[model samples]
Target: MALTADSPLTELLQENPKAAEILMRFGMGCVGCALASGETIRQAAEGHGIPLPELLEALGIEE
Candidate 1:
């Protein structure tokens, strides 16, 4: 699924375990944290200072 800032981390993680690799590759590995639980893909990427295009590509989502 294409991800957006409104996409729930919990839901995304459940549907796409590959998302963890994408997030961590961008230096966001706190997938189990409370803050991460509610954070969206864009939010997390921004938080980690990851470029949106790069993050999107890594997640297999077209930007």
Candidate 2:
């Protein structure tokens, strides 16, 4: 599935643990952190100054 700003990090990780690499690569190791448990991928990426499109690309998500 193509992830969006609405997709929670936890849910995505649950569906694919390998996705953790995507998060970590984007400097979002906080998917397991309390403050980011419910945060969306877009939100975390934005917070870390990472572009969402780049993140998706790192995760192998095609446009």
- Per-prediction backbone clash count: 0, 0
lDDT of 2 at 63: 34
TM-score for each model: 0.78, 0.80
Off by over 4 Å in 2: none
| Cα deviation of 55, candidate 1, in Å | 0.7
Looking at model 1, residue 51 earns an lDDT score of 86
Give candidate 1 regions above 4 Å deviation. none
Cα displacement (Å) at residue 32, model 2: 0.6
Q: What TM-score does candidate 2 reach?
A: 0.80
The best candidate in terms of TM-score: 2
Candidate 1, residues 1-63: lDDT per residue as tens digits?
665555777877887887787777778879879998878777877887888778777776665
Question: Which 10-residue window of candidate 1 scores lowest in summed lDDT?
Answer: 1-10
Candidate 2 Cα lDDT to native: 0.77
